[model samples]
Target: MKQDQDNCDFIIQAGHDIYYTHKNVLSAGCDYFEAMLKYDTKESREGKVVFKDVDSECVKNCIDFIYSGEIEIPNEKMNDLLYAAIMMQLEDVKQAVSDILKRSITVENYFSTRKVADIYGLDAVSTRCRVFFSKNLMKISMQPGFGNIEKTDILNFVKSEKSGLYEEAKLTLSLRWVENNRKNEEHLHKCLEVIKFDKMSPAFLEHLLESNLIISNDFGLYKLFNGHLLKASKRLGKAKGEIDNRDFIILFDADTDCIRSLDPIAEKVEKFHDEKFKHLRDFGTISLDSYIYVPCENKSVHRLDCRSKNSKWEKMKDMICDHGEFPRSVSWSGLIFVIGGSCHKATNDVETFTYSLNQWSQLQNKPTAICDASLVSLDDSIYCIGGIGQDGVEVSSFCRFIPFSAEWVDLEPMRYPVSDMGVVAVDQKIFVLGGCSGGIEVNYVSCYDVISAQWTSLSSMIACRSFVSAHHMGNWIYAVAYGKVSNVIEKYDFSKDKWIIVKPEVDQCFTIYESTFVKL
Candidate 1:
């Protein structure tokens, strides 16, 4: 039976609204109400309570939950309900509200929810938000509310192992945040302390010094970043933060089904991810984040997680059309583009795959039906370099592809006709290394400047062999001649136009035929 307002002994006033209830009903569920009603307080003698800090709707919901043991918790009123439950000492109601808030937390509402959790000292909610924040740091950092996050939370995220940010990225993000608040020099210093300055490369540190954000507004960081650059260049032995800071040249030999790791800085090669797989001939590989995608000639794609210790080749969605053998691939905007390869004969088939959706779709064919071409992504478009054209001849053909518009525009041809060459892009320039110019192997090297729209011939490699694989790391371009049994590895310094031999320093040599080399 419903009690009339006149018969109710307790009166609760929330803002302009009044809630009529009984002492027995209020005290049975709320400790705060029971203590007030039992004690000699003025509110107890008058049998009334006035709440100015809580919302009227939240107060009504809490009281309704007390009488009926159930209430609907709306998303918009979640924070108010939680605060009201806390004020009334409703343990069960508070727990239910907290669970609902945690369940509904997302990248968009994380900052607001975190503020509420911090206000109430909600450790569980705070911890869950931290975990969620770390996973989506890249995405959340771009949000408008990210700049308003507290300095302490930013530092904690910088220290998290799974933040998915490299040392350079972390430094840039911290500096960017500090740039927003120049008066907080103390906070900026604290943020700089947690970063592993030794892990940053000299080039990145120098680039940081050139940043107007640091040089113009914050001269103190300029000096600190400069000092770190000096220290980083002279630091002996391997750098710290091995998980996120280190870069390796991943060499996968499809013919022998063997994978090897080459530490570019140390010039050392080891079998770190040497797991053997079924023979994958003429497969193409591309590196994205921590995973490597291998599009096989068997029309299937496999992924390898570099972060996993027991990482095995995981099969992903198969291709919509048979990419066939010698398909060149590049990743842009989180999508994989597989260019022309050989089918019955040379085909200009093109396909794209989305890793998240686990689906593949066909794209417009290339202008020229080419196979064994070198594809590199830079700026916002992909460039397809030298390969064997439809006439079954080595070509100097060069073209630019815009994935956003699915448009292909022909650019200036290479300086020399080559196929199965080592090609890599760095600093808005593409370097083409040793490959076959005709039936005979050539050690010719060329550079194509995207900004200048011109080509320049550079110093040739020491080893004159075909089937070359190239990777760029830091300031060096490594070209591996895998056609011969020697497996000659040479690195080029574009600034000096010089090439030097790099020994593998491994116990066993790799049988590197039709291999893909990627920097991770």
Candidate 2:
């Protein structure tokens, strides 16, 4: 069949007799013809077959590849070759044509080629085009063909974890894309899923509240955003107990650098420092009454009693054993647990102090050296979220320590790695917030489910937030909004699954050494 092409016994015809080829030869290389010719049908018995609606030239090129494993794909006939190859299931020919087309992609043709790639299931080509679309996102999106991108493709691109567009730019362009195809406006919500709700400018969030596009469609997001924008400007609404006590909130008032007391019920902040303690930093606690602090200088323990008559910062006894580190501390069940910080070098040593005995004792060591990890105490356990791993790399690892067993068990990690994050526990589940480094960042929000042993991502923050400190009051969670564009109180309602920005009536902006929830 290969050597005697001119005297071939079988004849295959297609497209108005525009082309003809050998029967067995075409069947060997083409999946469609192989099964068709296996039977004693008229075409098989008579050694002839025909195909309509296929370009004669594309058919000939495919036949050439069958005989010699070589074919030239012209740019003009590229789509024709693609369609014919798919119809005949000529994988090798299809692959060769796809490779050539993929290499020839440009900003001018990315959208069109991507359409073809997707329709024909050319995944490799499709992947390449999507990446190209993401990298040159803004420039290519303004092109005419950008309007032709399918709604699913648009959703996938906006939420792409690899997308490098700035939050503001991404939202702006994406919203415009939505407006262009307003008939399919429901896809807008899906597009909104990947956007950083916290990263948007306060002014923009205000603007969104008034948009028919949002208010009429995104019911939950719209309602919560309206509440926040109103509160930021000192507008009080009838929504009571929605942002009330979780019992507590952590605050770092710009007017006072010391950690301040947050009054959730009255929506007020109170003085946190007395004469002897004008400054406090790097502290932790799980108990509502008093927090345990391991000072760095003398390495002494200090206590602030909310119920004490004097209510002054009192220095407790020095650590029983000098670990040579002032690690972050958290108190639970009248006991304080210390973990992570430099003890000459990064260490994972664990120690506990008893409130009754007032003595410190060593506990089981942690799995790895971690400093600057986000710590949250709940459910008789301490959750140690994202931190530096053994080799000093930012990690997405999550681990929990059971106080009774003095053992650390690893949990599923957050979707993104973060440092200087805020963790709040409400109802045995923990929510973790944002971190930024260098020039790139993620306004990521995710939660760990104790029951499911799974990590679920929540909506992103309003804007880029870093070094945020947060606490919970009932079902509502609040975090410090600290970025160049945002410095306010950001509230999140679990039921609403939306973020609200509240501006404190502070005289001026303030920074803090540390912030944590304390009952006063």
Candidate 3:
């Protein structure tokens, strides 16, 4: 085919060069050439085709593929060849180019290839590149070529839900982009708009404001950040429970006097203050705002600010009543509520601690005297699930308490009477996980729809766990193990109706017994 250039009947012009090719061979492989040659098009009449925007080498590659069924493409020429194939409507050539591009995607060249795939609308190649990009965002962002990525790609990535980066990480990436490019206000605004400032920590927001990056360059961004900071301050407590803040579960290990923070996503564990809480057992733990409050049996409370790198347990005011012996606690409306448990015996005593007030107030006692009950707050009320009643027998009784009116209302009973069950509320549904039923552990998982006032059974967990701390973060319910199964953590997937165990990297078994799991 290369030697038959002298007898060629067609001429192809591309970017300062012309190629000789047979018209019959051109029409045989490419639909674009066949249609043009079969019709009264100017190209057919003139016996010539022109692709002014395409490079000569790309045109040569396409022509070579038309004659030989294949063409060798360099990593640097894949984009241009793909473009030429798209223009020539060569489906096979496009597929081949896309495959090469997919295989060529690397951390260093991701931005460049992603840009080409996105521009040419190559879904297969784009999807693969995006997956690679999401998985290696940190590494890709640090590359020297990161600053050269298109603004559109950056904005799309920043707005993507599957970017696999935390809000702060996204913010850092955006700032780095702006710093590298020295972008104008219009571009800077788009970058700032996608970042979830409301989700970032107050300390990070403060640091961002002090940094010369934003403060020195853009006034509009500074004002916008200030507004976000103000709103964040107003809703700081609630923000601490947001999805970004739920990256780690902080557990107060009473036996070892250590605070263990476990990152379920990262599967890593780190311990702090190994000897801090010596003999700190039988305490009700609740996290509000960014602080973890441990209410001791002696009515004294110790608060730890999780924001600090070296945060220590600071003493707070004593509780008004004795909230001792496996008392159930929940944080609602920025207040810590410790419900019924035994001080001397099973008592209906209830107390709520206001962090802002630093004072504990006794509330009306619960109607039923119970201990080891699962307490979860939903909407404007608190639900106290099954537990052992004062008669020393486990009951399936369910009740709701309205804090505003201070009234307790009895509700539908659970299918099985259970105690020490992991219970948590997400939206209008409450999930009651494995617990003890008649002195035996049950892997039963039940969900109660508050709106319908009905209980429905879901898939059972792989392992039975009692005294599990079930936490609702993102879309899954994490049941942190207790008793002999302390090393296991089961995650409930709502969509799949299944439970999967999560293993964290820890040097020792999680001694989660009598330990509190607070999503931080």
Who wins the lDDT comparison?
A: 3
Model 2 scores a TM of 0.47
Angstrom error of the Cα, residue 104, model 3: value is 82
Model 3 lDDT per residue over 1-520, tens place = 4534688888898877878888899888889899989899999999888888788898898888889998888767777888888988989988988888888787657767888887999899989987787666655654556666678877887898876666766766676565556543347678777788777656456546744354546677788787887777567645332334444677655446567777766767777433376655567677665666777777678887765546667888887766557557887544578888743256698877655436566777898788888899875578999988888888899999976556899999999899988888887899999989998999999989999999999999998877788877677888886543345588888899988877777777646654455533
Clashes of 3: 0
Candidate 2: count the clashes. 12
Per-residue lDDT of model 2, residues 1-520, tens digit only: 2434576767656666533467667678777888878787887887776768888788777877788888878889999998988887888888888888779888667777987887888999988987787666554544555555678867776676565555545565565565445554666667767776554434344444533353547778577667655554342223232222123455544444444555666666555444234444333333422342434434577775533334556677665433333356665433467677532235687776654335566666787887667677775478888765556567677888876456689877777666657787776578888764332455788888888888888997886676677777666788764532125567897777898776555444565444566532
- Which has the higher lDDT value, candidate number 2 or candidate number 3? 3
- Give the C-alpha lDDT of model 2: 0.63
lDDT of 1 by residue, 151-188 (tens): 88788867866666677567655655654455544677
